[model samples]
Target: MKKFAVIALTEGGAQTARCLQEQLATQGFKVEVILPQRLAREREIYYRKGDFNSTMHRLFREYNCVVCIMATGIVVRALTGVVVDKTVDPAVIVMDEKARHVISMLSGHVGGANEWTRLIARLMEAEPVITTATDTEKVQALDVLTKKVNGWYPNFKENTKKINRRLAEGKAVELFIEPYLEKYVEQFNGFTLIRDIESHRGGTPLVIVSDHTGFAKNADIIHVVPQLNVLGVGCRKDVPIAMMQTAFTEFCQQHQLLWQSIVKVASIDVKKHEAAIQYLAKTLNADLEFYTAKELQKVSQKYPESAFVLKTVGVGNVACAAADYASGEQNVTQRYANHEITMALSRLHEI
Candidate 1:
């Protein structure tokens, strides 16, 4: 659930915040209202009159969304010191004490301020004030598009600005996405899809969606890497973390895969507590899945199996079997092994 912090200054604002909280709760949002000590009711956080700036700074870092029921000037001044790039900042919305209008103050697209503004407006029956050019023009922002497709930009700050600027101006934007990613973005409009990346001329703004490396070498191309690869690993009982990291890095380099494209790490259930596997998953910032030997055994026949592994772990294969089962697809690569680690790669059916 998304956590929301509602900041109210006066008695009227406090009443509006409570009503908004109750409405948002019906929609399954976890809402907390903050008020001054004199106006605070039960279950609300109260602060000293002079501590509003500090309270805003703390809530900005802690919550997914912050709704300030006060003057827009107060919110803009208070958040000036705490504001960061849209990628890391929380969605910010501002409303008057009477709730006449709810404004999407900052981080409208990537941080979801625009969506929240519309929801709050609907629940409160207030007018939503959104000034983002993409929303006004009914064009899809590149950042929002990547987010919807479960992708990440390799160069987010610079590339996003250029592509979104073209979109806001109603210029043509070309998308060169791999076939696997076509299904996810087929519903979105406002972009021409290029079937082949090599046929594109250099002058037009282009966005490429792929998991391959070296596609972002050109400065003009915006590359969104899809998180679709699943890695299955088997390691020695106590392999060093550094060695495991090095082995995984070299494996990706050898396979021409981008490490950022890996979405999950899979292993046998018995090795769930292994330090090296944990380190690899944490380093990749990917989901970790552990399958029981019985589950893995069902898919072990598809790959070459080791008699020693079957005797030790009750499964003929660990890496390939676990990856194939977890991904619900055949292993993309044959089993790769070094001195202490064995690994296999598979692709998720969707992003």
Candidate 2:
């Protein structure tokens, strides 16, 4: 819940202001109203009573945002001392006496006032006022990406500020992609996918399709940090409603592996709702996007039209090709399941 100091400019406005504050407070807002006149008897609210302008500045510093039941333009003009910094300012929103609508006049971007106004408008049946480049574009929050990546513990304030700076300045941020076997590199699988690429750096030399080594020191190539990432999957014969998950995890523990190395689970398009697979992916905090049966069918090279796969599922095959169709390549870097099936891993650089 957000804390707001509602400044009531007039005595008559205090009741309406308290009502509005309660309206927001009921919607999980902790609001403390400052009635400059006198605290009312019907609806008593506690606040530090004082000069409106100075008190508002103090409240602005104390709270996430401020809500006022008064004329916004007049309030803004009264606080000529408050707009000292373009950045690092509190979000301030003003609602009219009747609380018909909310206006985001100043500090719309830096203060995150626009989003707060939207929430306020939503609860009070008021219109949210928004006008900012990033908001207008509806950019995805970097925090969401941080949440999606298991290993990414972000420095939110610093990272977002730098990212925002780069975005504002139109700078390019480079990411590197590398895929290799964990046993070969002695590192986690798929951990090298999002490594930063630099002008020049060293890397674990790669062995080709076979066990062969390539030199990076003598080669003319830029330096890149390899982030390994692999998608491991197990599904029903034809992905029959999400049971493939148990088989996949069983495959993982059957072999010795931690789930963090696996990015997402996969299956033929028909397995989209496979319960066990979906639950497993959700448990691992990963995604279960599928490809066509023809994709994974490529792995084993021979999966005749199964009466089960065809009747039970629309897909006609169960080869690694089918998994690869949804995943990528015939790359079964790790395999399990009585040798009859595999919990394969695929690497992807981009969405």
Candidate 3:
């Protein structure tokens, strides 16, 4: 569940916070109210008697998003020492005491403050104060697009503001799309499709949509990797996380696959609780799925088998079978295994 922190100081702010908590709860948010010592009433209120800034700092570290129903100046001053990078910072929104306006204060784009602002404003019938250039200009934001298509932005730390500024100025951007995504390119504006690399002239921001990795990087190029790959992993119970990471990276690099394109890490149900595989999945922010030995046996790929593996796990080919089951693809990479771990990859067709 999405966690939300609502900080309120006054009686009027507490009333607004309660109303917002009810509305947001219906939409599946876990909203918690943080109140000053004197204003605490309900059992749910987190009453802090000491410094407000310290309380806010702790809340900012704990919650996914924070809403302040107080003066904008107060919110800004309270967060001065706790603010971090946009990619990792939690979304922060400020609302007027009367709920007449909702402002997206920080982490508007990547952290989804702008989107939350719109949702809260619509629910409360208040005016949304979005100051982001792309939002104000109605330009399609790159971060939003990447999230929608399950793509990864490799150079977001370096190139986000530059690309958004170009788009805000209505400058044309160049897009290199895989044939499967050609039909969907019309949804974006200010983009000219480049059919061939030789035919491309270089005067605009570039977006490349593909599953390959290590494309040449330029200041203007943004590599968008679609989440089209699934990895089936088999490992000894005591395999180390570092060894798994090395094996996974080498496999992707050898196959020319983008490590970021991996959407799921699959394995037999018995190895579902393996720490190394779980750590790898958490690092990629992908789903970890486990299939029963019976379910894996149903996949009819002609994978190489081991009698010892079959005797141990009831499936002769764990990696290939799990990959086929997870990605619904018959093709798989050759088994790449170290002494401790085994991995195979499968690519899914574009939707």
Candidate 4:
């Protein structure tokens, strides 16, 4: 569920925050209200006047979205010390005590401030203010689109601005996406689809959606890496994290896969608490899934089997079986094995 923090500096603003809290709660959002000590009521967090900046920083760190029911200048000043890059910052929305206007103050696209601004404006019957160049010009923001598609920009800080600026100026940007993601073509507005990046001429902004790294050498090209690969691992008891990391890195290099494309790590249910497996999942920033031996045994018959593995884990293959089961397919795309670890790779066509 989405978490929201509503901050109010005065009694009237506290009332507004309470109303928003109720409405947002009914819509399945977790909302908390922060008010000044003099204005805070029951069930509200209170802070002193001198702690405004510190409080704002704390809220930004704790909440997914922050609604400041106060002057825009005050909100801006308090946030200047806490705000980070657009990719990691929380959405910040500012509104007057009277609820006349709801402005998307920071992280407009990647952090979903514009989306929250529209929702809050509709709830309070206020004017929504969004000033992002792409939004103002009615053009699609690549950063926002990437988030929606479960993708990340490899060159976010530099190439995103270059491409978004060209889009805001009403210029056509060329897009070359992997065939597996062709179903999402409708989302790419104001972009020309090119069959091959190799055939494209220079000068037009280009965006490539693929899992392969180093597909393009141009500094201007933006690479949107989709989360489409799953890694399955099985290791001996008490394996070192360094060995796991080395194996994972080598596997990615051998397969020509980007680490960002790995969406999940799968392992046998018995190894769910294994530190090496957990470390691998955390390092890849992917979800972890554990399958039972019975579930894996059903698919393990097709792959190569080891007698020692069967005696130890009740299944001939752990990595390939778990990967195939988690991917909802019977085929394992790649497989690797060492003395202490076994690994498998699977590609997911749909997110």
Candidate 5:
């Protein structure tokens, strides 16, 4: 179920969230409502925040997406001091205290503002205000991987054209979405929608979102994507894991990278393999590792953050560094694991 954190500005905001929660419950989404203390005059509210900072600190750390009963930007801005976790930044949705339309306010693309809005709109028979580029496009039916779209993925340049061409042709197309991705439906459309193991009839076009291989046998399900990128980082000495994380996030955004694209976390043996790195990786369902030092020195192209630990572990940095390097060729574009993880994605082309 798509998880949502409903945050209300006032007592009535909390109650509004409750009504929406009951409605969303029927649609199969996990919903939790957050509110301030003694806001509602009539109804006895269960939730109350003592220290606003700590309350939000714990909440963002736990939830995937947050739906604000009102404007939540202030709450989010205030919590910046304590909690820095965005691993599961709740797709922020704004609903009125009057229980009007559910408006997706932030994280529209990946956090699922679009699909959640569509679902709520359907339930309430209200209009879903979707403000996204990809959703309003003319999509084609084709076997194309769902690449993370923080910006232009040079590798996807080829695949995008193919999807457009297929779309232009009027050939029947089928879209495949991860059942778990139900929350993101509104952000995307135009392609035919399909659930797991569900095959399409005849030669319809297919779009897919899977972390593994072998989705459907028919040419109908055209693409299979790992749908995430695994980042194996080796920072220089004493580069606090916090700094590493901050820097990495900046690098990704600067590169228009998708936070979801990073699945696994990695580091070299010399770094003591700290908890912060593991925490960041775990948030993305990725494992943490400390490879031999020498292994990294070799794949110097993607340098490991070299430290004295290299002297402790005998191996060179080559292995760990090579672990980060990808074949410059666009065909080597898939990730969710280290380059050495050995994936047979080529089979996707067989159909």
Candidate 6:
């Protein structure tokens, strides 16, 4: 479950914190209210108390989100030494004691502070202070879209800020949409759609919305990879986690696929307890789906027939059938095999 911490200082802050905590709890968040020792003890408020700086820092590290019901300056001071990269840091929001305005103080976009700010503001009947340039200027934010589509930004190291800034400045940006996403082209307001690569119009930042990762690299190119790929695996019992990681990485590299594009991992139901495959799925943060031998047998005809595999595991090809079934698509990559595992990749087409 996602955890949230609500920190309050004064009496008004405490009251507001309680109200916000109740609302968040209803939305399936594990929330806790942290107040000062004196106020908590005297008022018998059910909360954690003492060491404001330490408590806030701990919550920042452990929680998915943190709402500080106090002065913005106090929240800033407490977070002075705890702030980190926006991508990995928890979303931080600050609300005044009266709760008239909710400010998205840290990790606004990718970390979800902007969205949370609006939700909390609505609950408190407060105005949300969204100051992100792309949002205020009505430009779509690529990072936020990435989150919504289960997509990833591989070239985010240098171009994240640059792309958003250029969009906000009204500079033209071109996009190449894959066939699966063609129907949603109208959702993007400021991009010129490219029909093909051969036309090659130059001089603008390019955004490629596709499931493949084989695009040529350019300083201005941003790849928005949707998580519509699935991986199927058949591994020897007791293989180590390192070997699984190496094999998966090699499979992605060989196919020119992004590791983040794999949304799920699948295998024969018997292998569900295999630690190596389980570890790989956990590492990828992908869903692990298992198929019975009967289910695998049904799809085996669509893939390469492996007589030995069928005799041993009751399925013609574990990796191919598993991936094909999980993706609900017939298009799959050729089997990639290592010493202890056989893997296959499949792409999904969204209607």
Winning model by TM-score: 1
Q: How accurate is candidate 6 locally (lDDT)?
A: 0.82
- Judged by TM-score relative to the true structure, which candidate is superior, 5 or 6? 6
Candidate RMSDs in Å, in order, are: 3.9, 14.0, 4.9, 4.1, 13.9, 5.1
Candidate number with the higher lDDT (4 or 5): 4
List, residue by residue over 35-62, the lDDT tens digit for candidate 1: 9999997767989979999999999999
What's the TM-score of each model vs. the native?
0.80, 0.41, 0.75, 0.79, 0.41, 0.75
Of the candidates numbered 1 and 2, which has the greater TM-score value?
Answer: 1
True lDDT of residue 132, candidate 3: 89
The number of the candidate with the highest lDDT is 1
lDDT of 3 by residue, 191-281 (tens): 6678755555676678888887666777767888878778998987778888998888888778888778889889999997889989999
Candidate 3 regions off by >4 Å? 149-155, 179-190, 193-199, 214-220, 226-228, 234-255, 272-312, 315-317, 320-351
- Alpha-carbon shift of residue 19 in model 6 (angstroms): 1.7
lDDT of each: 0.88, 0.54, 0.82, 0.85, 0.51, 0.82
TM-score of 3: 0.75
Provide the lDDT at 22 for model 2: 78
In Å, residue 200's CA in model 3 sits off its true spot by 3.1
**Clashing residue pairs in candidate 1, if any?**
none
**Distance from true position, residue 312, model 5, in Å?**
49
Off by over 4 Å in 4: 98-100, 123-125, 182-186, 236-255, 272-311, 314-317, 320-342, 345-351
User: Over the stretch 1-351, how does candidate 5's per-residue lDDT look in tens digits?
Assistant: 556666676767777777777888887878776666666444533356556556556666676666666654675575576543222355656666675666766555445666677887777666677654445554422221242321122234455556656555544556666664434233443566756445666655556665434444554444444433445554444546566567555545444444554444555665545555556667666545555545545554343333443454443342234235321111222322222221111111111
Q: What's the CA RMSD of model 5 in angstroms? A: 13.9
Instruction: Give the poorly placed runs of model 5, Cα more than 4 Å off.
Output: 40-50, 72-88, 138-351
